[model samples]
Target: MQETLFCLRVGHRLPYSMSYSNTTDFTNPSTFILLGIPGLEAAHVWLSIPFCTMYVAAVLGNFTILFIVKREPRLHAPMYYFICMLAITDLVLSTSMLPKMLSIFWFNSREIDFSACLTQMYFIHCFSVMESGILVAMAFDRYIAICDPLKHSTTLANPMVAKIGLAVVLRSAMLILPYPLLTRQWPYCKSNIIPDTHCMHIAVVKLACADTRISSYYGLFVLFCVKGLDMFFVALSYTQILRAIFRLPTKDARLKTFGTCSSHLFSILAFFIPALFSSLTYRFGQNVPLHFRVLIGNVNLLVPPMLNPITYGVRTKQIRDRLHQLFSHKDI
Candidate 1:
């Protein structure tokens, strides 16, 4: 059985304690201290440098994509519009975690206030949902273009695309809003250590004095409904897209369409596969090595932002050509 000991305010500190005999047990402790960056004491400088480098790269890369889409009139289309939305989402996603992560690594301050921690969790989930929606929109765009070429323009006109984008943002925001709000309402005892680097939703909920059975069930339901459904839609879209491609009269046209969607396919895989593993690891495999768990966690958070621009730029010839032209002109 599990027990929660909530310590009321006594001066500026509160005391909370929990003990776990096995990995499956959540009732064992109310709070576990998060030891950020496992080998921090001995080689703090070495660890901080790489983290900072990745943060900068993630920011710059995502912003560059955003700028190119906004400034270039020729690149204005439904496809690039969705790409811009994705770039913006990645920017927010990275910003949500990187600043605090950098501070923790450089200054060795892992003490995050309860309010700020919940806020971070909110933005993280919000942007994550936004990214998933954008990918689904992109897949739908591809499906219309490949499967219904004659009506592609009529089906995905500017006005229709704008509405779709707005709907995506609104729906995602609504889906994730409840999670953070519910998490913040739970009182935290003095023992406020988190096992992971960031304030993960599951880890935070486990600290609550109130029963978290409803929260956990709601979270799993939301996870399956959002991520799982989006992935299934993407797969279904590609199935029709592939079928249409094979039916094409000419080989060149099939290859051209394939090239257009290749980046999206790569990005979809990169984002979802690591996320699936991270979720499974947290839910089922607590005994796994902490470093390995952390590595998977980072992959879900960092890899998507870093890979988005590279994958899109490489696969989309127009973006690649524009980048080349910009660099070549700068050399002169």
Candidate 2:
């Protein structure tokens, strides 16, 4: 969708407008005014340094994951394939929101056309949901490997893994496609200033000049279906994994199993805890500072993509060795 719209500005800015015309003449605002981060606009310059560092680190780290996974034929298994998918999701999600965020912070470029805002929200939410699914798939793979090793390769072969990845992407896109559409139809007669950096589903939806119960409930529904369900299954899979681990005969065997899962455990916590906390805080923490909420939001979005590759580098021997080899060659 092209964001280059010819807008006709009208009416004074109301923070929460609730007057929709009874007759139908649907026209969207030409541009949305994003406030970047309320109460911290003065520090946007200082903010950009860290945000830029995060963006650079996230891009470089995820690219390294992609490079290593693609370069080494030996790493072309289902596990790495899933990790690669993870890297892709992280890359896309971060890229979708952050650049504009940085532009807002650094350049005061906050006017996003209605279509562009909707497009950004769609990818951000879709990739976020897709990420949860990828994590679920990773947990399932670990479950089968640890609990049913004899059937691991056959069950999650190349074809099966490919299909699983495809299904996850498709499922997320199908479910989340309605989100942008729902908000797109809303009348934005009031203030278009989003409190945060980017166009989140709720942030955009909240701008509607109507009773937004349906959109709000629908957003909650998508959240439950995406993050809620994925986390439930992941927790379930880990419960079984722990049960299987304790049943191992040797102490060393159990420790070894723990070692195998430590990276994934760390990655899961790194991604989910901050994200869950951020969302919950926004939803429930009435006293939390808007700037604080915005900080957590940035961490939840940027940190996982930045850390996933680092986790692989520290835990996976193949990735570590490959990094060493590449750097060593570069030095020469």
Best by TM-score: 2
* lDDT for each candidate structure: 0.76, 0.82
lDDT of 2 by residue, 244-295 (tens): 9999999999989977777887888888888788877776778998779888
Per residue, candidate 1 scores C-alpha lDDT tens digits across 1-332 of: 22232111111122232222212333323333444545333454676676667777778887888877776788898999999999989989988987777666677566676667877888888888889889999999999988887898898989999999999989888988888778766655424556556877886887676777877887887678889999999999999999988888899988987887889999999888888788777777779765577657766888899889988888888788778877788531
Q: What is the model-wide C-alpha lDDT for candidate 2?
A: 0.82
Q: List the residue pairs that clash in candidate 1.
A: 14-190, 16-190, 18-29, 19-28, 32-193, 33-193, 34-194
User: Model 2, which residues run further than 4 Å from truth?
Assistant: 1-27, 330-332
TM-score of 2: 0.90
TM-score of each model, in listed order = 0.86, 0.90
